[model samples]
Target: MASLPQALPEPRAAGPAERPAPPPVARVRRRRRPSGEPPPLPRQLRASGRWWLGLSALVLLACVAVVATGTIRYVDVADTRVLQAIAEIRSPALTAVAEVLGLLASDPVLHAIWLVDLVLLAVFRRWRHLMVWLGVGLLVINVGAAMATTLQRPRPFEVEVLGEWSGFAMPSLPVTVLAALLVSTLYSLVPPGRKRTVGKWVVCGLLVLTAASRLYLAQDHPTGVLAGVVLGVATPLAAFRLLTPNSVHPVRYTRARPAHLDVSGDRGAAIVRALRDQLGLVVTDVSPFGLAGSGGSTPLKITVKADDTVRADESCVFGKLYAATHVRSDRWYKLGRTLLYGRLEDEKPFQSVRRLVQYEDYILRLFSDGGLRVPQPLGIVEITPEREYLLVTEFIAGAREAGEAEIDDAVIDQGLGIVRRMWEIGMAHRDIKPANLLVRDGTLYLIDSAFAEVRPSPWRQAVDLANMMLVLALRTDAERVYRRARLHFSDEEIAEAFAATRGLTMPSQLRRMLRQQGRDLQDQFLALLPFRLPPVRIQRWTWRRAGLTVVALAAAAIAAYVSAGVLAAPL
Candidate 1:
């Protein structure tokens, strides 16, 4: 395993005239394409399921229109002639093989494949794929039933019926269901690559064999099999491609975070170009930095090439990469918090990735301007418009996490002073956990201002104070931390801070640390206070929360029921 790269070098004292000059930009109208590498596939051609979906819809509409106009008799003649042609060459051995191959589209086989899909998706924790699969199944079932009843086209009358069948055969339900099951499995389970390309041919081959068997046996019209193939395959393929594209919801067999995009190929090159063009920084390498500790965004330590213009001390910089996936994750997380805690102050989801990064950038500048010990805000780099962004800031050299570093009186005072200053500025670092607090040369610096908010609720500010104290006490003791906190916070304020702090109020990292320490840190801090206040009520119920709760419970119940049935259904 490779070691984590070093942090950004500390800035050196320099005169204003020595500011780094802008990087030289070369304008190329149409640079010759690189050799050997294939050109990028267009998005529409890459994810062509939506085109197939539209084609299927048009074909279905044409069939329905022909039926409404009483002109389907002409299509039936074509279907009958095709069936007769297929039957002309049918022999016993061929028929036996057709029957065996046809079983691939049978209910039991389709059901087995469906169940296997459900199992694999569930085992992989792909809730999105599972939900879409279930939705497609329900859609196919309802649509097939409706078409059968409405069209009411019987089996081919021109040829003797040779095989067992049931229900109106205008659109073969078995074929439709089979196509859906196989296509969904291909998109959901198989990764997008050469294997998927090969899987497409296999899917086409299976559908052709099943349709041919039905036509040779006189069990379905040619038109009916065509309709089934269109409906079954197109629906789920379009849904999967549209909803869970491989770019975002990749089929990975690793424990890596989903929001972290690969920054090795085109994206890495894009980042380098964007940083140079937008922020006037020339990068040398863009390897992932501190990925093991980061869960929300991709933390990158960019290495800049040091030249006469660029100082050696400013070679490295820190950045957090934000993209559409992080925006969705933020929305879901905020929604979950709102449902659980009844909108605890500014829980609205961000509208876009741009806004999300903009808010953090604004907060970082706000803190830096207000004399907070935060990283100096460099700037924001646009990797891709509206889809991705890179927030650049100063990286403190020789900094260790506050929890891992040795703490003393000065460190404790600095930590308490940060909370006090935040209260003074009417801002709160909503996440005051150990990870966000960095200690360098006995100076505590606050990072990850993504969760910092202005004019935050008093409860939120108090919780910050409590969380900070808890973190400070992790290395020191609660008694000593409280003794120092009094210098910054009054007795009443300290009581209120502890009172506002509770289970969900503290950050998960803080709570987990306290739990692992096996000590009632909150209680110990409260004991040192002059007086105890009643525990603040954190849960507040509202109609909105109640409705969301009901919806969440209903969705979970449905998922459980479907999963159980899929597992128990007989093949």
Candidate 2:
């Protein structure tokens, strides 16, 4: 073979050719200012100069206009006639509109709105907004009363009537209330983006409708009604703007404490003495039960005194006692089912006493019927005009119990079993947590069924189970807990339940504990496992005789090879 031609000698490295350096980066030149030049004024200050002067001038003009209008009072009979004509032209449409507006203006509607606002604010913990709304409502009512007295304007003497009236004619109270309500409503419904255009039109429409109703019903002269409407709208708006955030008054209730009074003296004796004096329940002795607990909403419990009963029917004594001056804070638990507290001691006949008593009694009976343990409700009593009401129930005697160091596995199993039973009965305990489950005499008792409802859904059940698991996992091994859960539940079923609970699981508690202890062990183990497996199928086959012959030849060759190997090894 001919030798391959010698590979061409590698080219020698080229000598460094001189490279031109990059052109020097161009320097940014700085412009020089005149030596004696003064600094420019800020844009905001320049803009403000003309704005402030214009605002002052406009306000001065408004003041002048208001004074001029107040002094120059000419009854515009011609304008009144024009309004009447317009009203007649749109009488049918106006009547229909009035009916809808009238519903809003009604006392019941306003009261309902007030109650709803109160409940919402309370639920959201917006104490400040609650006070603001309450103050605004009260101020409106007061202003209406003041204007009715001050104006002393008479009802219209010439127009046909359409509605009933009882209040003073001038600056009509109803019309004033309607105006204030319309202003407040418009303020609420109109947002800041559309404040100028949309809000103005809505408010104008309300004013027109209100004025028409007043004129049609002959409740007041056009001048008086118009004046009332203006004042009602203007005063509240001004107050809202001028009143500092802290000016509004808030309602609060008092809680009695031991430090506020001498418990050994007659003064303190008077607090619990009412049990035997008024309610006919006897007190054997008084003992301090530590600090009273309240839910921060409605009825504040303070310095509860345990009393012994004279008769077997009298299980305990309860009463509304005066507050001791030492306690500075307000504490109340707004009971969801009923309003059981908040009243003066001197008032006669409790308000809504029957409803309160009925609910208390009904709750006790339901718990008993449902095989759920609960404190026995003895009776409910309300003292006269002072709306103070009391519900006496059998108290579960015990210390403030500590949660068990470890949740019994059996208890967890039983609790879930109970939840399943509850579903079978078409019911659900909406609020299920460790705090509501009582461990008395080694038995589990579910308490606080106030949020219970009739419908039990998979989502609800899952949440309930997840919450229970979370409570147990706080004091037990998560893997063990999961294994126990899997014993009774299929993996897929557990996964579905876990999904419904939004991924809340016992492993979260483990992670939290590890973090607290400064440990870094990664959570690599899986908690939820799938339950169902894919199906398997078997196939049937038909074979010809040729396939059998091939199988027989392969078997004979394997046997012959094995026999030859054995003989060769022996020889």
Question: Which model scores highest in TM-score?
Answer: 1
517, model 1: CA deviation in Å?
A: 3.9
Candidate 1 on 95-140: residue-level lDDT in tens?
A: 8987888788766787788778878998988877788888988788
C-alpha local distance difference test of each model: 0.79, 0.43
- RMSD, each candidate, Å? 7.6, 35.7
Model 2 lDDT tens row, 424-473:
55565655655455555544555444345556555566556555554445
RMSD in angstroms between candidate 2 and the native structure over all alpha carbons: 35.7
**Best-performing candidate as measured by lDDT:** 1
Task: State the RMSD for candidate 1.
Answer: 7.6
Q: Candidate 1's error at 257, in angstroms?
A: 2.3
